[model samples]
Target: MAEHNLGDSHQVFDGEGKTFTINDKHVAIFNINGDLFAFEDACKHMGGSLGKGKLEGNLVACPNHGWQYDVTNGKCVTENECESGCRVDTFPVKTENNEIILSLPE
Candidate 1:
Protein backbone atom coordinates (compact mmCIF):
# COMPACT_ATOMS: atom_id res chain seq x y z
CA MET A 1 0.00 0.00 0.00
CA ALA A 2 1.02 3.58 -0.50
CA GLU A 3 0.05 6.88 1.07
CA HIS A 4 -0.09 10.29 -0.56
CA ASN A 5 -0.90 13.63 1.02
CA LEU A 6 -3.53 15.29 -1.23
CA GLY A 7 -3.78 18.74 0.31
CA ASP A 8 -5.59 20.70 2.99
CA SER A 9 -9.10 19.71 3.92
CA HIS A 10 -10.42 23.15 3.10
CA GLN A 11 -9.07 23.02 -0.45
CA VAL A 12 -11.56 20.29 -1.30
CA PHE A 13 -14.49 21.37 0.80
CA ASP A 14 -15.87 23.57 -1.95
CA GLY A 15 -15.08 21.00 -4.61
CA GLU A 16 -16.43 17.84 -3.11
CA GLY A 17 -17.58 15.15 -5.55
CA LYS A 18 -15.45 16.72 -8.25
CA THR A 19 -13.19 14.48 -10.28
CA PHE A 20 -9.41 14.61 -10.42
CA THR A 21 -6.63 12.26 -11.42
CA ILE A 22 -4.35 10.63 -8.84
CA ASN A 23 -1.70 7.95 -9.25
CA ASP A 24 -2.83 7.33 -12.83
CA LYS A 25 -6.40 6.78 -11.72
CA HIS A 26 -9.29 9.20 -11.78
CA VAL A 27 -10.29 10.09 -8.23
CA ALA A 28 -13.12 12.17 -6.87
CA ILE A 29 -12.30 13.52 -3.42
CA PHE A 30 -15.07 15.22 -1.54
CA ASN A 31 -16.07 16.38 1.89
CA ILE A 32 -19.62 16.08 3.12
CA ASN A 33 -20.21 18.43 5.99
CA GLY A 34 -17.06 17.49 7.94
CA ASP A 35 -16.58 13.98 6.63
CA LEU A 36 -14.22 13.03 3.80
CA PHE A 37 -15.01 10.83 0.78
CA ALA A 38 -13.02 9.28 -2.06
CA PHE A 39 -14.21 7.25 -5.02
CA GLU A 40 -13.37 6.21 -8.55
CA ASP A 41 -13.82 9.11 -10.91
CA ALA A 42 -15.87 7.26 -13.51
CA CYS A 43 -19.52 6.34 -13.68
CA LYS A 44 -20.55 2.73 -13.99
CA HIS A 45 -23.05 3.34 -16.78
CA MET A 46 -21.12 5.12 -19.48
CA GLY A 47 -17.64 5.93 -18.22
CA GLY A 48 -18.68 9.47 -17.47
CA SER A 49 -16.41 11.26 -15.05
CA LEU A 50 -18.08 11.86 -11.74
CA GLY A 51 -16.38 15.19 -11.30
CA LYS A 52 -18.72 16.66 -13.85
CA GLY A 53 -21.71 15.15 -12.11
CA LYS A 54 -24.02 16.90 -9.70
CA LEU A 55 -23.79 16.15 -5.99
CA GLU A 56 -26.85 15.29 -3.93
CA GLY A 57 -25.65 15.05 -0.39
CA ASN A 58 -23.65 11.81 -0.39
CA LEU A 59 -25.03 10.76 -3.76
CA VAL A 60 -23.83 11.95 -7.16
CA ALA A 61 -25.31 11.76 -10.64
CA CYS A 62 -23.33 10.51 -13.57
CA PRO A 63 -22.80 13.13 -16.19
CA ASN A 64 -23.32 10.71 -19.04
CA HIS A 65 -26.49 8.89 -18.09
CA GLY A 66 -27.81 10.33 -14.84
CA TRP A 67 -27.03 7.24 -12.87
CA GLN A 68 -26.72 7.86 -9.14
CA TYR A 69 -24.35 6.43 -6.58
CA ASP A 70 -23.91 6.84 -2.87
CA VAL A 71 -20.24 7.43 -2.28
CA THR A 72 -20.29 6.17 1.27
CA ASN A 73 -21.56 2.71 0.38
CA GLY A 74 -20.88 2.68 -3.37
CA LYS A 75 -24.42 1.59 -4.13
CA CYS A 76 -26.83 2.54 -6.87
CA VAL A 77 -30.01 4.38 -5.87
CA THR A 78 -31.95 4.58 -9.10
CA GLU A 79 -35.47 3.19 -8.63
CA ASN A 80 -36.39 -0.08 -10.33
CA GLU A 81 -33.46 0.28 -12.64
CA CYS A 82 -31.71 -3.02 -12.32
CA GLU A 83 -28.11 -2.05 -12.72
CA SER A 84 -25.05 -4.08 -13.45
CA GLY A 85 -24.05 -3.97 -9.81
CA CYS A 86 -21.03 -1.83 -10.52
CA ARG A 87 -19.49 0.28 -7.86
CA VAL A 88 -16.97 3.08 -7.74
CA ASP A 89 -13.68 2.10 -6.25
CA THR A 90 -13.39 3.81 -2.86
CA PHE A 91 -10.38 4.78 -0.79
CA PRO A 92 -10.00 5.59 2.85
CA VAL A 93 -9.44 9.28 3.49
CA LYS A 94 -8.28 11.22 6.52
CA THR A 95 -7.83 14.78 7.66
CA GLU A 96 -5.10 15.61 10.11
CA ASN A 97 -4.84 19.22 11.19
CA ASN A 98 -6.66 20.21 8.02
CA GLU A 99 -4.25 18.25 5.91
CA ILE A 100 -5.94 15.77 3.60
CA ILE A 101 -4.45 12.44 2.65
CA LEU A 102 -5.51 9.29 0.84
CA SER A 103 -4.85 5.80 2.14
CA LEU A 104 -4.29 3.82 -1.06
CA PRO A 105 -4.52 0.07 -1.11
CA GLU A 106 -1.42 -1.85 -1.88
Candidate 2:
Protein backbone atom coordinates (compact mmCIF):
# COMPACT_ATOMS: atom_id res chain seq x y z
CA MET A 1 0.00 0.00 0.00
CA ALA A 2 1.10 3.53 -0.78
CA GLU A 3 -0.07 6.58 1.07
CA HIS A 4 -0.42 10.14 -0.15
CA ASN A 5 -1.03 13.20 1.92
CA LEU A 6 -3.91 15.20 0.50
CA GLY A 7 -3.40 18.45 2.37
CA ASP A 8 -5.83 19.81 4.94
CA SER A 9 -8.97 17.93 5.92
CA HIS A 10 -10.89 21.18 5.97
CA GLN A 11 -10.54 21.36 2.24
CA VAL A 12 -13.37 18.87 1.97
CA PHE A 13 -16.24 20.10 4.05
CA ASP A 14 -18.91 17.88 5.51
CA GLY A 15 -21.27 16.52 2.86
CA GLU A 16 -18.85 17.43 0.09
CA GLY A 17 -16.16 15.70 -1.99
CA LYS A 18 -12.95 16.54 -3.85
CA THR A 19 -10.95 14.84 -6.53
CA PHE A 20 -7.22 14.26 -6.60
CA THR A 21 -4.81 12.73 -9.04
CA ILE A 22 -2.27 10.63 -7.22
CA ASN A 23 0.23 8.38 -8.93
CA ASP A 24 -1.77 8.84 -12.08
CA LYS A 25 -4.89 7.54 -10.39
CA HIS A 26 -8.01 9.66 -10.16
CA VAL A 27 -9.50 9.49 -6.70
CA ALA A 28 -12.44 11.19 -5.02
CA ILE A 29 -12.33 11.96 -1.31
CA PHE A 30 -15.56 12.72 0.51
CA ASN A 31 -16.20 14.18 3.91
CA ILE A 32 -19.37 12.83 5.42
CA ASN A 33 -20.18 13.82 8.98
CA GLY A 34 -16.54 14.60 9.68
CA ASP A 35 -15.47 11.18 8.42
CA LEU A 36 -13.55 10.73 5.22
CA PHE A 37 -14.09 8.21 2.42
CA ALA A 38 -11.98 7.74 -0.68
CA PHE A 39 -12.78 6.03 -3.97
CA GLU A 40 -12.31 6.08 -7.68
CA ASP A 41 -13.66 9.25 -9.27
CA ALA A 42 -15.12 7.74 -12.38
CA CYS A 43 -18.64 6.40 -12.65
CA LYS A 44 -18.92 2.85 -13.95
CA HIS A 45 -21.89 3.35 -16.26
CA MET A 46 -20.77 6.42 -18.17
CA GLY A 47 -17.41 7.52 -16.78
CA GLY A 48 -18.91 10.50 -15.01
CA SER A 49 -16.90 12.45 -12.51
CA LEU A 50 -18.01 11.31 -9.09
CA GLY A 51 -16.18 14.14 -7.39
CA LYS A 52 -18.50 16.64 -9.04
CA GLY A 53 -21.60 14.57 -8.31
CA LYS A 54 -24.35 15.58 -5.98
CA LEU A 55 -24.18 14.15 -2.46
CA GLU A 56 -27.22 12.85 -0.65
CA GLY A 57 -26.21 11.42 2.69
CA ASN A 58 -23.69 8.65 1.99
CA LEU A 59 -24.61 8.32 -1.65
CA VAL A 60 -23.50 10.51 -4.54
CA ALA A 61 -25.49 10.86 -7.73
CA CYS A 62 -23.48 11.03 -10.91
CA PRO A 63 -23.85 14.40 -12.58
CA ASN A 64 -24.02 12.94 -16.04
CA HIS A 65 -26.31 9.92 -15.81
CA GLY A 66 -27.78 9.92 -12.29
CA TRP A 67 -25.96 6.76 -11.25
CA GLN A 68 -25.63 6.63 -7.52
CA TYR A 69 -22.80 5.23 -5.37
CA ASP A 70 -22.37 4.90 -1.68
CA VAL A 71 -19.37 6.98 -0.71
CA THR A 72 -18.83 4.98 2.44
CA ASN A 73 -18.29 1.64 0.68
CA GLY A 74 -18.15 2.34 -3.05
CA LYS A 75 -21.28 0.35 -3.76
CA CYS A 76 -23.53 1.22 -6.67
CA VAL A 77 -26.98 2.07 -5.33
CA THR A 78 -28.63 3.02 -8.56
CA GLU A 79 -32.33 2.14 -8.66
CA ASN A 80 -32.26 1.09 -5.00
CA GLU A 81 -30.18 -1.98 -5.82
CA CYS A 82 -26.56 -2.94 -5.81
CA GLU A 83 -25.98 -3.74 -9.42
CA SER A 84 -23.59 -6.60 -10.00
CA GLY A 85 -20.32 -5.59 -11.60
CA CYS A 86 -21.14 -1.94 -11.13
CA ARG A 87 -19.07 -0.97 -8.15
CA VAL A 88 -16.18 1.44 -7.98
CA ASP A 89 -12.83 0.89 -6.31
CA THR A 90 -12.37 2.31 -2.82
CA PHE A 91 -9.31 3.35 -0.86
CA PRO A 92 -8.39 3.72 2.77
CA VAL A 93 -8.55 7.23 4.22
CA LYS A 94 -7.26 8.90 7.36
CA THR A 95 -6.55 12.29 8.85
CA GLU A 96 -3.57 13.41 10.91
CA ASN A 97 -3.14 16.89 12.30
CA ASN A 98 -5.76 18.23 9.90
CA GLU A 99 -4.08 16.61 6.93
CA ILE A 100 -6.01 14.11 4.86
CA ILE A 101 -4.18 10.93 3.97
CA LEU A 102 -5.21 8.36 1.41
CA SER A 103 -3.94 4.87 0.73
CA LEU A 104 -3.79 3.25 -2.64
CA PRO A 105 -3.12 -0.37 -3.55
CA GLU A 106 0.23 -0.86 -5.17
Q: What is the TM-score of each predicted model, taking all chains together?
A: 0.86, 0.94
Give candidate 1 misplaced runs (Cα > 4 Å). Answer: 80-84
Q: Which RMSD does model 1 reach against the true structure?
A: 1.9
| lDDT tens digits by residue: candidate 2, 1-106 | 9988989899999999999999889999999999999999999887899999999999999899899999988989887554686789999999999999899998
lDDT of 1 at 1: 55
Off by over 4 Å in 2: 80-82
* RMSD for each of the candidates: 1.9, 1.6
Report the CA-based lDDT of candidate 1 relative to the real structure.
0.77
Q: Write model 1 residue lDDT over 25-70, tens digit each, in one string.
A: 7888776887888888877767888767788888888888898888
> In candidate 2, how many Å is residue 13 off?
0.7
- In terms of lDDT, the poorest run of 10 residues in model 2 is 77-86
Give model 2 RMSD, 1 decimal. Answer: 1.6
